[model samples]
Target chain A: MKYLLLALLPVVTQASEITTQRQEELIYLLHQDCGSCHGMTLKGGLGPALLPDILQNKPVEFLTATILFGRSGTPMPPWSFMLTESEAEWLAVYLKNPKHDEK
Target chain B: MLSLSLFAVEPRGTGDMGIVIERANGSILIIETTHNSQLYRVEGLGDLSHASAVFSRDERYAYVFGRDGGLSKIDILAGTLVKRVIQAGNSIGGAISQDGKIVAVSNYEPGGVKLFDSANLELLADVPAQYADNKQSKTVGLVDLPNQHFIYSLFEGNQIWLLDAHNPKQPVIRKFTDIGLQPYDAMVSNNGRFYIAGLFGEEGLALLDLWQLDKGVQQILPEYGKDDPKKPVYKMPHLEGWALTDDYALFPAVGHNEVLVADRHTWNLVKKIPVHGQPVFVIARPDGHQVWVNFAMPNNDTIQIIDTLNLTVIATKKPGKGVLHMEFTPRGEAVWLSVRDEDKIQIYGTEDGQLRAELPALKPSGIFFTARAHQSGL
Candidate 1:
């Protein structure tokens, strides 16, 4: 039973809900603006890799919190002032499974 | 049956040499205006997370400023790096003196400004930007003046500095402590006569007439943003406020999807042009007949063309997703625009708005040409 649950964990986790317009906007933000520092491919530049393969190991809750309240002492500015808690969580979940958005 | 052919020797002096920032790779893609194609790619400098370049007086040497405290002097003619220096932990941008002798860098980490010798990249003067109980603040909006002076604004300090690098031995620095509010970004006029800093803490912007520095700072557009309450500012808009054409100029209404046109002589509000999104770069065409604009993000893909005479948006085209920057040819005959996600730069004819050519690039951000060498406050 434990082995079966582990096998389904990847597909069970879903991206936070967002509107179509908001999703398009978020995807553009992730690629262009953030891509200015992070790699356009999300492979990492000044900021660390935000790719799904690297992000999978990190906790989704922690990632969502970081998106809202940016890392201090680094170049990342707090996005909560501009983005909502739900929106930040949506971005966090989407980053974990970037290819899922295409489907 | 075919005759032997040889290529033209690359000119030592500037014709159309320029650079495009490859942010993710810490390199620059070189191109000439004539070919509209890539000449070479120079890399291995340092961190270029956010980078900008300024050329020498002769337009032969290019000074590349990287965000990771790296400054490199590259020879455009030889296509090689002359010297490199790690100036700061993080830098926003830099400026070059009129005489081409001094180079100034604005830094974020351990906030301050550093002046370097244009020849050897040697440290000449160091001004630590400290204020509000000795807290070092990030510096922005650094521009060059006709004399040996360099002007920049501090974000946390809420101060604007005018440094006189004329006397290399002993530099004279002036601090304008009171400038209304938060000085975010700044730019000089086309002729290098006026230096204006955009204030984010409040509505108005602080303007300093470089011709008369002792006259002090004056406030302009005091209630620019006060009237609009619903406009949501996503990312901080770059405050290169006005695009001067003929006797008037155009300024973006920061967070709002509108642009304010004002008179150059009287400094009076002329018209407010509503755009599709929050405008970032409201640049005037060289011919002074049209203006081209791009947005911050989310709405960044749409590039709009505004008629200078009519003061209205003449045309709008969504070039691809992630349309980052647009650069006009020297005579305003063509425009080179970058679509970052597509990894391509499309050139269009200004007269017909028709796509002429497309060039491939690797995540390009800023497109700077050597022709800016002869200009001021790039």
Candidate 2:
């Protein structure tokens, strides 16, 4: 039980590092800024879809790395200048399991 | 004593009417320029995330091209959806032919241009973007030429094809391959002669003279920004946003914070005007007195106006965040701007640079007017 609690501590700590307002802003950036290429609904456009089903096979670490350092040959630009490593990881997790549809 | 009739039709002209895509909701606001008010809210358009519109010749109807391949013809006078058809799996935009008898859509998914009978939205012909191994490439930079001719660029195929669709069933396509690395978008000159495509993977633009098709695609300003460091483009520059004057042409330099000005006749690089961030849209006014420019992310809120006579950015205005698009009025008296984050369509005087009016909108991206019906390559 102690190991289980220890294993979950990092995930909670990473997510809690982002404030509520910053989380909302990140979500807006996901739907608007990232949506410019990936479609506002994340169905797909120039870039591929980001829907859970489409991204189910892609590992979260791969997506987070791609988010931080874009693919070299494609039009997907790097977001490292704007996003931190942990923030990108949080976004990657959020993309895999979106919670904004709760409204 | 006056006799009133319930079936009497109101006398009106559609030149003052237009449609604004409510992008998030898949709805449109039927608006008029005179009153600046929405007449009706038409709904059920599929995936208007990157929607565009083209007006019929009569200006009574608008054919809306949605990102999800939904082609809808709306009656501006009646304020209702006349007809709609999912022509492809995914589409970027569309164009209306010179004769107004046909409508051509540029698709991204199935990778081709599909023509439809403008009267009733019936599929007429399909020109596939075929290349190596019968692989498909997304079509872009679609523009209609003067005599039922259409031109488009293939992004992945690295080619441009001109389709002569005089006959709805049959088309004579002229393919110009090896044009550039990645031709993202293209535009035809106002006089209907030159077709220029902006390359996404290179430093210059691809040019083709319609009058002299035998020469093939010519590279212009092949090294405009060769020495500069390429910045990551948040949004690709719209070639349709280029402005051509009598003696010069001003367009955005891809991945660079500059607007390249070239001689109109010689196509030689005249000067590189340093600007704020990367310009996404560098459009000219109707009279060619001034040019207005808007940039990509981080600097998207600012608009810079240039003096065409002096070739300098005379003024700059920050009209709130997310300045997605700008459209000049018919006579160039005023320009309408879509502020996405602010949820407002702000109007500004072209000459004075003053806030003329403001209209409420829900994340408006493109603000197209009916006046585009008569313009070439709008």
Summing lDDT over every window of 10 consecutive residues in candidate 2 chain B, give the lowest-scoring window: B1-10
Flag regions of model 2 displaced more than 4 Å.
A1-10, B1-9
Runs of candidate 1 with Cα error greater than 4 angstroms are A1-32, A35-87, A90-103, B1-12, B240-242
Which of the numbered candidates is closest to the native, going by highest TM-score? 2
Q: Over the stretch B24-89, how does candidate 2's per-residue lDDT look in tens digits?
A: 788888888886778888899988887889999999999999988899999988888999999987
TM-score of each: 0.83, 0.95
In lDDT terms, which candidate is top? 2
What proportion of the true contacts does each candidate reproduce? 0.10, 0.30
DockQ of each: 0.16, 0.55
**Model 1: residue B84 alpha-carbon error in angstroms:** 1.9
Identify the candidate with maximal DockQ. Answer: 2
